[model samples]
Target: MKPVSTWAAMLSLSLAMAGCVTINIYFPAAAAEKAADRIIDEVWQLKPDAATKEGAPSR
Candidate 1:
């Protein structure tokens, strides 16, 4: 009974320590924002002012 309780305690302690680990992750916020902006621009098909282009063909 004592050995079983000790084993259980050790297992719980190991699991607790594993759960408390702090993992540091590096993220490039500026690059992510730029990429997101580019995707949004592509999705919206943003274009410059049509009137500004003197040579633009009109349909």
Candidate 2:
């Protein structure tokens, strides 16, 4: 009984420490493009929709 309770306490402490850990991640992004006049055609794997073509309004 003592060993089982001690093991549970240790496991809970380890889990609490892990949950308190902080991780930081950074991603590079384009803030501004040289051709600001041009419309954005794509982002990542996304492409422009036919209804959202440049110089035309969406239906």
lDDT of 2 at 53: 69
Q: Ten-residue segment with the worst summed lDDT in candidate 2?
A: 36-45
Candidate 1 all-Cα RMSD: 8.9
Indicate which candidate wins on TM-score.
1
Q: Put down candidate 1 lDDT per residue, 1-59, tens digits, no spaces.
A: 44568888999999999999999998799999999999998978845555357677655
- How close to the true structure is residue 36 of candidate 1, measured as C-alpha lDDT? 97
**Candidate 2 local lDDT, residue 13:** 97
Q: Evaluate model 2: give its TM-score.
A: 0.41
Error of 2 at 45 (Å): 15
lDDT by residue for model 2 (28-56), tens = 44534534324454433365574376556
